[model samples]
Target chain A: MDFQLSDDQRALRAGVRELLAGRFGRDRMRAALDAATGVDRALWRELGEAGFFALRLPEAEGGVGLGLPEAALLFEEAGRSLLPGPLIATHLVAGSVKGAARGEAVVAVLDAGQPVAHLGEADALLVLAPANAPRAPGGTLRDAAPVRDAAGPVRSADPFTPLWRVTDPVEAGEPLPGAGRLREEGALLAAAEQLGSAARTTEMAVQHAGAREQFGAPIGSFQAVKHLCAGMLVRAELARSAVYAAAVTADPVEIAGAKLLADDAAVRNARDCLQVHGGMGFTWESDVHLHLKRAWLRSGQWLTAAAAEEMLAGDLC
Target chain B: MDLAYTEEEQEFRARLRAWLAAVLPGLPAKPRPDDWPGRRAYDTAWQRMLYDAGYAGLHWPVDAGGRGATPTQHLIFLEETERAGAPYVGANFVGLLHAGPTIAAEGTAEQRARWLPPVLRGDEIWCQGFSEPEAGSDLAALRTRAVRDGDHYVVSGSKIWTSHAEVADWCELLVRTDPAAPRHRGISWLAMEMDAPGVTVRPLRTLAGSTEFAEMFLDEVRVPVSHRVGAENDGWRVTMVTLSFERGTAFVGEVVACRRTLAALAADARRNGRWDDPVLRRRLGRLNAEFRALWRLTQWNVSEAQRAGSGGVPGTGGSVFKLRYSHARQELYEAAAEVLGADSADLDREWVLDRLSSLSYTIAAGTSQIQRNIVAERILGLPKGR
Candidate 1:
């Protein structure tokens, strides 16, 4: 009945936080962002060893069989460190991926267009969404004119496209039932991602506000900064509650509600976090925009906020 | 994390529901018969019945003649009562909600014996005289003086917004005991008997066209020093206990009343023919979502309280719940008015009447601005600067 973490939960949180702090802390995240590079294979393997991606799987399958609440805690830690990878997608796939002997499988979801990996780079690309079956040239990604993305070098909003755009709009594989489609479960997943990113942004704001001084006082000591931080806290707390509640319920209506709440928090908090950092936050080096971009990406990852609300309205009928 | 109630809790709920079904008064419970004279009379009778049945003070202690129920049980009782359109507690809101709790925490053994048993018996009603004409939101600015005179405090001042002062037998009042120090530090919380000499009550007509509140004029009103709830110059702490009652576990009933309004709105929307309209549908849908969030919010708090075992005031969480509930209170009525259309204008239509009464929610209990300020300054730790 307590809303707080139990002693065991706290131990788990401490272990995960330490792991993330060592592997993907600000230094690692900054390096990766600055390099615009490939997956941190060593760190990813460590995470695998730690069973980060196997929390939800049954005990029979090399997993802890923890519920979504536990996964949610791990995911939040992942977000705080701003770890780079399709951690969410990988976890979602870990349950279903059978006979997996992998050279690092990074799962990413896409809508409208799939972001494929460099043809030689990824061992397997899990395509989230396939093009319309009614339309021709649908099963594979098409319309691929290689365009340099504003984000990292290899990551794609659409999981089918390689580091460079391919001729097809689909990833090169047999499409699953929900490659990049909206599902209540998937909606919650996307919302969780946003929740993670939003929480990071608030931390970014808080940390920066404490250290960065202006005129005479820490800008955080200023009332406006306090208000901004407070506002971010309010938004983040409510969104966290919504996401956590929905994740437990598995109700589509709650999922939509959580998605909307989390998306707003993530996007808005990221923006506010950036503003708190002033000019440095807007630059490429601060790693602030990375969170904002990730927030923007995951906000519409499974379904647009508008679409979620509309779907919720439909349920009301 | 699970939202389902325990089997025992559900059985408790069923038992309460069945009891309420058999015992609820046959007469109407709201709007028409429950408004003003008819309503007040019905409420008094019903509360007396509840006291006799040991259902009155669901949240009160066993020694105080209550059922010794958990917070969830208290919640379930209120939920069932509201669903049955049961009579509201007339003249006892202040007594049951604030005064009783304050006295229990800060009252002496003799004081508790003198005051609590009669109040629990529903033989007497109590009023709150905290708000002053000058000090509304700025409650600490109150100038109601309680000068110490031998064995008594000669209180000479006026109290505004004293609910049911003309009818209640006593008033749980806040008065200044020290003028030399700071404002709040100098105050003392007292129990003032309404029948004492040098006290006058004048009914103030409100927008509701009824004297729901009174202005009490005190001229050397003799309050025995023994009647003071706590230490001298520490009324602020005592009043804090009463205010906590409004925002903590006890506030569950009031919030349930709000959820009932939403449920009634939904039913009326379906029964009346407005269900098909897209605008109404969206409004109701949003309300439905908000209602679920609030239900979760309340349950979350209840769960924490249940887990805590020893009771205490909810700090920031209560503020969040109150703010959300107040916002939803207004929205529930607006959606109802749009559904009822022409009938929304009628005072007898409970929802419509509720639509009007809803304004008092944010204004009377705590202003929306005060809540925002509380969130701003305390809960959120945001600075409120010029």
Candidate 2:
């Protein structure tokens, strides 16, 4: 009944956190916000080199053989750093695609019947077919039909996450083995990211509340602001527990539960954090909005709140 | 990171479950919230049953007349007992949870011999005399006074929100022994007789129409100086120890009970056809998820204690779990009320009873406001507010 992270897990978490802090810290994230792709490829390569993309891959496959929990911890760091990219897709794809483990090939997963994320930027796209189909790949993504050049980039809520709609959709090909498992894993990892972002935003809000003074003292001295910060902390920590537990259990119901809490924490914590920063938080110069924007994007990813709720309701029934 | 209990812990749970299964049927049904007499007898019998079976004081050390179970085993005991629909420790709560541990920790040898055994055996009932009318959240500001009078302390002051005071045979009293000293420095912890001369207990009715709490008025109630748990004027630390235990595994049962309530509510929603409403479904689903997270958070804390090899006080995490559980509990009962709609007014329905009593979940132990302050100032390092 121990909940403490093993020394190895702790070291792994600290190592990922330190690496991300040094490589894709707030400053680096801000710089990438307005970049052409809104992603730091150099940092991505560095992460791949550090075995971030290969952590969950079997050691026999020339990769680090860690479990989904370890992978969740690494993605939590990514979320904390607000590292931009199709991180879960890329990491999961590395399991099937060669070169991806080395960060040489960028892979994006297209939700069945939805616009493919990183449609043009990614080197390959993997589409998940419905369960019960034959165990096979949905064809190599690079070989799939592409959208016309006239299809411009769709405006995204998060400036760091640019969306693209594909006009030329590929027909269903071969099905991947246990696509449902992959989807759950993807949701779990995304939840881990949301946990990180939630925690980071909480810290950001608390730091601002302590430093930014109004009236006669720091606004944190006021009950209203203090309660808001406290609420944010609660949301973040609750999501954290859910995320880590799901990582350990890897149960579909637990994963759905984690996604629900993580989405709430990520989105609500960012908004409350913005409120804590006041008018300055409304401006683009403030990173608080960045968190809110990213949270909005992630909430709609792999498993949305609505979808997660549906899964949990099914369990209740 | 393991959440599974040990084989020995599993065996303990199986044994407890079988015992509960066998004994629970023969016992009288649990009494209503207002059925104090019936409940007193039922609860006393249940505690004695538990004590005889070596289930009482499951978390305490063996030398202190407990099973010396690990933190995980203690949690399992709580979860399994609550899951079995057994009665709560009720009036004996203070004795088993608070005074017994305090005696073992800070009391003199004679005090332990005199006080600890009866508490485990359900032969004595205890109440806390800490909060006064003037001191609710800021408990350190308590003005309860106790002046030295040779062999005894002549205590004179009032204490509010003392649970089970009416039924309690003894009181863990906190009084100010030094009026000139700082508020937190002059306090003293004493084991006072509740039935002593010049002592008064006035039962206070709550919104639930239950007298689970009472106000204690002490007009020169003489408590032997030998009853002091610690050195004179050092009661503040002793009080802290007692309060920490109050916030400890006491909630483990509540958490399990809450999970059962949530499950029953979901079942109600389905029965009443309220589960189909997308809005209500989402709300119910979200709540189910929150409850799961809260349960996991508790497990994580217990696991942490096990990993630390420090037998579970929960420290600051206790406040976090309590605050979240309170909100979750209230929200759940409110949703149940919504599900019941007009049927919620039926007092016979258990959910209605829960809805009525849910408000106290946040108010007792420590209010949500106090909890947030602790989380902010202690957990998050937020600046203390004025």
Candidate 3:
């Protein structure tokens, strides 16, 4: 089996990394976090022009039509650079979103019963909108909702997207109540995000281990931290196999299992990465916290571990 | 990139599967062979059968009596063989796996032309005589001496952990040919008849009550100069090649088998009362995760081998695999024991012979601790730990 990435996928990842390395570097990440709107617009359009948003769209629809595997690699680079915006959600709903506006659009998967960021800022909103769930509604604000009236958006320690007040609360979408095509795609996408997050955190951990020193030596020399980093690499790579395999198969059962694995990997790797970075990881200046916060926040969104478990149990059984 | 096999490889797999299906002879219903030695011989005979059937050396070069398959084909062949639960190659274990290969690499043309074909044909067996009472992890500290006499080298001193030496036809002995040189630089490797006069083989009894390992004393066991595979004081290099092949694949078969066991154990827990224990389930979950991770590493290494030759990367992924896999293996057996409880018959019956065999994967191939050290020093570029 081929473990090497396709030339195009590799090129896509390299291109995205270059874009982020230039535009969404640490300096830009800090500025966007402090911004009132909580987004870096110029870079987002640059991504749009680069065909990042058109990854899943069919060739007939003027897009690359690559699967989640390719998308996962690109997002991993995004997480590595810690790029901003609700790119995942908008892409997830792109098939049904405004055509020409899909690339320019921004949206967030409702996090813990609240939409993250200002919903009104998006050209279109792609809310989970799970029917009949208890949540504080943002009420409709023209094309979007206005939930947060007076508040500064919180920027996670990560250099990426700043979290805004959850103004537009879409009720928890019923987990579709059944297993079919939609659940599969949703779970696979979740896995793709997790793969991105885990891979990013792993790189973060590796870099920290290499540079960070303790007692006149790189702390990575210590077996404890080495084992942790090694274990993190193991988990990230394992989940990757499942993720890539499921993407190849497009089988819901396989996808569900892979998603569960990838989710656990990202969540676990982020925590372990924080542990590896130790005090530095806890510092506000360190980017480790950003990944931890996002992993923590995302770990609960869409399919929470429990939700994925339930889906997995149903599908696998 | 296409992960699926090409047309030729698929056909190769199909043909090999069909041939194996047709030719694989039956074993005992309960496999209650007379004794360990008998079982070992049975395995040897089966290996010869496979050798004759042209499945023994799927990865060997065509010039060396192998199928001359590509690395991918070799991987497919190995995976398919494991899938078929093929028996281990018994008699030629060390010969074909180690000595013969060493000869092929460092031996003179006569040595390769003479020693390889017999071993390839399963007419001879070989055992490694590297470790001694003092040379455990510090293998270079071996004090076994082989001084040059007229036309032969008089070998002296003892070698421990000399497996299969008792029944084997020959021993691949590494000894100090020059005492004045550095510990690693003064050694020489020689292949000597196991039954040669002045050679003594005594089986070492382990706590498991089987004589799987041996201690051999060579009191002037004169090995002909023709048997010298490499230069006079350079057995260390030759021995390095022998020990190097000791690993690299990382036993993907064991990983697959353990994963199958893990799943079955989980399902068993669900059916036969133990499933409710959250602790056990959590343990299973951890093991399941570890298995997946280690298996991926194995696949990556195999892929690396497919792209690059057997000269694996200088990175410590092998060390990582050895470290993780050894612990996982011990965990798997221990978990099986836990599930079996005091009776432990189910576990025992499944692994009575293999239990002792399995312990050696870590201890024999390379100690887990040793692997960890390698990872730290070579792979991670860390300072040497005392």
Candidate 4:
């Protein structure tokens, strides 16, 4: 029983992290945040060209034909780089929707009851409607007619993620098969992303605690600060292990549990990271607040805490 | 990579499982038979049964009367044994796990011939005399002294937490042979007879109400210089060898046991009708996740060791595992206690005992604080504490 990644997986992870680091560093992230499009089109195209969205697509379908674990690893880098847009939605619909696999067309999903994020930028949307809802012409993106955009972008707490309330709801798109699988996949990848962010915040907290001194010593030397940093490490690692294992298992309940841990790690680490940075953390100049905001937004995305709670409760009982 | 055991490993596990199933029914059950002699008899009898099945000292070297199992096989032994809920390795632990390995690594030819077979056969129970009243985590700073008196060394000072001291026939002792040298420089490792003159053992009861440990007073107890395992004043290195064994694949049993314990905790919660409570269920789920992580982390550590082979740079990963395992186990039991509430007073003695005993996990090997320091300083390369 080996938990260590294969040599190929390690290389792939290193490649993805380096590529994301080069393309979506802090300055570029800030640029994306300030831009009207809210995403770097060039970088997005590069990701497609590099086969990011096509990772899990079958080799017969002209994709890299990797598994969910590899996809999880990629999203982890996305989370670490704080890459914006509707990532999980686009990734999930990539195989079914034309151009989505190639990353040429951005896709969004009406995420259950939540407002559809990145609606303004998405060329297509994947909606899972109830069995009683009005059916449309087709399920896949190939047959669905191009729908006109009727909603404008609404300001979101996470500037990187733009949201829009559907003013003119589309009643045409067919419901996708295995909505539960899609949610589980999304939750697993989101958990991976959360693990990345949690790990980054831990590093951030440790770095800040080392540099920020108060009483003739580094704050990290103090037990309280040391313990906080330690707690961050523990939470991040715990979530990482869970996320990685869930990716392997691909069980819905396991994924929900993984999401619960990842949510705790990401949210708590971000808050603790802000505390470690003091007043500077609250200002727009510091990126700590960006992480906290993103963590909050992501926690509510695929599997909200309450939803994950209920899923886990049902399983336990 | 793969979580399934190899075919060879599965066969080994199957065989061991069969052996355990065949013999375990005759073994004593919990509540541990209050009489001291009966308890000792039960423990030694179990060890003898294990020895007869060639299960004793399976991890030790082939030349030293062991099976010379691969690292993975050793882990399988631990896992299968624990899963079978076999008797605890109480009296023969030090002899089989620690002293035997140390003797193999450092003892002379004559020492191996004298000690190795007895340890493997459970003829001579062994206990560790490493910790002292003054030295626990800072073990190298122990002040127990052994001065030369002709062909024998007159040992003085005391050793605390000498587990199974009362029943053990021999002790793997560490003593300071030179007071003038630095703390770590003057120590020597010895194989001393527990019944040597001027030796006294007084058992110490822990919070769990078990005299699982004892303090031994040695006043001018004469031990032959020939009993020393390594060169004089080089016991620190020998102690390191023993400690390295402690940090090895022995953790497989404990990890499997922890998973079972967590499962039982979940069952208890469900039985008590608290599983429907979202908050409690969520905590249970989180605990389950943490346990899974620790399991994977252990596997990862084993894989890393395999990749590194013999001379790889030692990591602080053990400290990480220790910290996380203790935290998770403690939380699982504490959560059980909370969920049990007033019912804990009269119901489910196992939960009550486990909740109280779990606190010692953090404090036993190295306190959680010390583990964090190791992580921050050694692994993370943070500034050392003042």
Candidate 5:
């Protein structure tokens, strides 16, 4: 009945955090944000070398052997660092896509009729057709042909995330076995990332509240600000429980619910964090808005709130 | 990261389930809610059965004449008992949960022998006399004075919200022993006999219209100094210790019951065609997620307690659980009202009655506002509000 992170898992999380901090810390992240740079291929390959993409791959396959829970933890750190790329898609395709396990290739998934994120940098694009969509005759994974591009790269709310409109009458690639489950896994990972952002924003809020003074006292001493910070912690912790539990259970309904809560936590926490910081949070120079924008972007990714609600309601009704 | 129970814990669960199945049906029908004496008889008989079956005090220390079950085993006990429709700790709540544990932790050998056994056996039920009319949230401000006089403390002051006082044999009383001392330091904990002379219990009717709790008046009640659990002027710390006992798996049984109620609410919705409403269905679905997540949070807390080796005191996470669980409970009953429509106003309906009782969840134990302060000041390291 031990439902906490094991000693080994704790080490794994710490290791991932250290790696992300050393490689793509806040300074580097801000640099990319300022420059509006696309995905850093060097960091991508470094992450591959670190076995980030192949975390869940079998040890027999020359990959780091782990499970979804470990993957969730690692992705949580990635989310905390706001490490941007088609990480989930590339990780999902690690076993099937050549060179993906080593970060030599980048894979992106197109689903729910949304624009493909990081498509220009992606070596391979997997179109995960909606379950209700008519089955196409070809594979689900395909080469990223320019012909598939309906529109050029568009500005994204999250500056780190690049997006491209994929053409309609979208051609599906080779059949990906367990594609439905893969979507659920994607949702879980996305939820884990949101959990990380939620927690990070909470820390940022608390740190700011304790340091920022107003009316001759630390703003945190005020019940209004304190309660906001408290509420953020509650949301983040609750979402964390859901995300971690869903990772272990791998149940679709649970995953859907995890996504729903994680989205709420991330988006709402970021907004509250902004409120806590007062005027400073509104400036682009501050990281608070970045988190809010990113959370907004991520809320629409993988499993969305409306979709998750319907899925859970379907199970209940 | 394992959530599965060990083979031994699983075996414990199975054995307890079988025992509950065998014994529960043979018990007498439940007494009326207002029947204090009948309830005392029914609840104590159930506690005695648990004692005889070796299930009483599942989490108390072995040296204190308990089973000395691990935190996991204790959780399993709660989960299985609640699932099997077993009776709650009812009249024996204060004795088994609050006063008895306090005594075990701080009482003398003579005190243990005199008090602990009766509590474990349900022979002497206990009630809490801590909150006063003037010192509800700020309990340390209680003016429940008890002047020392030889071997006895001449106590005189009132305690409010004393649950089960009508049937309680003993009241776990807190008194201000040193008026000049600090607010937190001037207090002392005592086990005053509820039947003591000049002690009065006036049952207080809750919004739910139940007299399960009362206002207790202690008019020169001479409680022996030997009844004190800890040293004089240290009752505040003793009260804090008692509160820590409530953190980890305290609301676990309630979570199970809430889940059951949610299922019944869903069933009711389906029968009444309220399930067709997307808003209501989604609300229930969201609540399901809330409860499921709360259950996971419980497991996390228990695992943390096990790791910290704190003997099942779950630290500040209890405030987190309490803060959310209280609101979630209120939200669940609100959803039930939506499903019930106009019938929700009918007090005879179980959900209607529960909906009323759920109102106190955020107010009782610790108010949600108090919980927020605990979470902020204690857990988040926010500066204390002036």
Candidate 6:
């Protein structure tokens, strides 16, 4: 069984990396972060043109004929570049929502109990009922009425991702068919992003360790720093295997485990990466802290550690 | 990225499963851990069965008188065998996995003719004599000396951590042949007969109270120069050849066994009311993810080996796998102990024995600390530590 990425898949990932590097490089990302900008419409449309949102849509439906594995790879690149906005939500709704596949409309999904992300920039909103809530007879997606007045943007831990609290009781809307599947897919995608962050932070840590010197030698030559970098690689690689395997299997339990590991890897690797960077990692000018903050924010989104752990534990019993 | 096995690979698996099912029932009861002769006989008989069935050396090259199975087929072989409760390589481990392969790669034609067949046929057993008391992680610093005299090398000094030496027909011996040369450049590899005069094998008891390994002392042991695997003062490089084989799919069978152990632990927890504790359940759950990820990592490595056409050499990725799998194994047994509660202290229990043995995982093969150095310097391009 060939479980490694195919040449075509590698090309797809490289293509995404090239696209991101050219369009949303580090300088551009820093600029957006500093300016506190919302979703970039131009960049969003460009990603849509690249078939990012419609990656999993069937070719018969006039969309890119790909699978969740490919989607995971692309989102990994998104995560590596720290590309912001409601990327997963928009991509999840691309099959159902008009213009979403083409990136003309930005879709923001709201879980019943959770805050809405990118509520202001979203051209359309899809509200998902809480998993435990009762469902309507025939599940269907109803166009949600504008509830912008219900919430205002709140300060976000991740500067690139804005959050809003819904003060009013927004309608649960019709229960989307396969809501569970949607949530699992969302978790898997989020996990893929976390895998990307883990890997990126590992690279950042290794690069810094090799260049930064102390006590007449590169810090990397010290056992302490070398072990930290090595540990990051192990965690990232482990999470990567889980993420890719889950994408292929699409099993609920596997996805849950993948999320659990990916979340841990991303958050922990970022912290270790910061430690490797030493005092410079503490400064805002360095990208290390941003990764840590973003990882912290992402770890709590989609399927959280507690929720994923419970799901996995239930499987064991 | 297809995880599903090819039709041919599936057929291979089915055949192996059926063979295992048919043969396992007729096998003798397993020997006691302390019974070296019984273990040697039992393990070698199993190896003979595999040899007769053309299943021995499943991953060894065809030229080496093996089945020449692809990495995927080899993985399937391991998965099915471990699942069927078949015996491990055991006493033949050094012969089949280490010395035989190394001889195949670097041995002379006469060497292959004399040594390779017995190893594949289970007619001989081999033990590694590479690590000495003074040269554990720093293996090249071994003080084992072998002075050349005529056509024989008069060997001296001792080796530690040699498994199966008590019953081993041969020792894959590493000796310092040049006293004046550099540590790594002065070594040589030899096939020293265990029955040779002045060779000694003293069984060493592990923390698990098993005599699976021994301390081997070679005092003026005369080994023919023809027994050498490679050139004199080149044992270090010869040893490096075996390291590649060790890393790739070495833990594959162990991963399968660990998954089974984890399942049994969960079942035990459920029966004993330990499952009611959310903390324990979550701990087991996290371990479940860890092992699951490790299995996937194994697949990834095998796939990579297949792609690189390196004949199943998994490269530095093995270091990555070893670093985690070793610790994960320890963690798995620790979780088992937690589920066992007070019963964990009972020496008679299998879990207790396993938990004790698990302590060596991080320290054995290559210590976790050494593994990290390899990963950092090789995989991550970090500068080597002084």
Model 1 misplaced regions, further than 4 Å: A1-6, A98-103, A112-182, A199-228, A272-288, B25-38, B202-212, B245-283, B311-314, B334-353, B376-386
Runs of candidate 5 exceeding 4 Å displacement: A131-139, B310-314
C-alpha lDDT of residue B64 in model 1: 61
Q: Write the per-residue lDDT of candidate 2 for residues A1-317, one digit (tens) a residue.
A: 66658889999999988998888777777777766555456767887899988888789987899898899899998888888787787788786666778787677776654555565667667776532232444333443335425345677777777677665555554454445477788889999999999999999989999999988799887788888888888888889889998999999889999998999999999999999999999999999887888788778777778878877776776
TM-score to native of every candidate shown:
0.84, 0.95, 0.84, 0.91, 0.98, 0.97
Query: In candidate 4 chain B, what residue range of length 10 has the lowest lDDT sum?
Result: B306-315
Clashes of each: 23, 2, 5, 0, 6, 0
Please tell me which model should have the higher DockQ, number 3 or number 5.
Answer: 5
Candidate scoring better on DockQ of 2 and 6 = 6
Using Cα atoms, each model's DockQ against the true complex is: 0.26, 0.68, 0.26, 0.44, 0.72, 0.80
Off by over 4 Å in 2: A112-115, A129-151, A167-169, B246-248, B311-314
User: What lDDT does each candidate get?
Assistant: 0.70, 0.81, 0.67, 0.78, 0.88, 0.87
Clashes of 1: 23
DockQ score, prediction 4: 0.44
Q: Is candidate 2 or candidate 4 better by DockQ?
A: 2
Candidate 1 residues A187-248, lDDT tens each? Answer: 67767767877877877787787678787667776767766776676667667777777767
Ranking by TM-score: 5, 6, 2, 4, 1, 3
Can you write out model 3's per-residue Cα lDDT over B1-386, one digit (the tens) per residue?
33567798899899889877876656533233325556556666766776777776665666666666665676666667677777655556788677876887788878888887777776777888989899998899999988889889999999998777777888998889899998888988899988888999898876566777789998988899889889988898886765444233537666777777777666655766665665666566556645755655566666655665665344465666776677677787776655555545543455444454567667766686666567545654554434
Q: List the residue pairs that clash in candidate 4.
A: none
lDDT of 4 by residue, B247-317 (tens): 34656777788778767777887788877676887777667666766776676666666656543235467
Residue A196, model 2, lDDT: 93
Evaluated at residue B369, the lDDT of candidate 4 is: 86
Tens digits of lDDT, candidate 4, A127-235:
6442122233223331222432555556788877788766555664545654436767887999989988999998888898889888888888877677777777877
Question: Best candidate, lDDT-wise?
Answer: 5
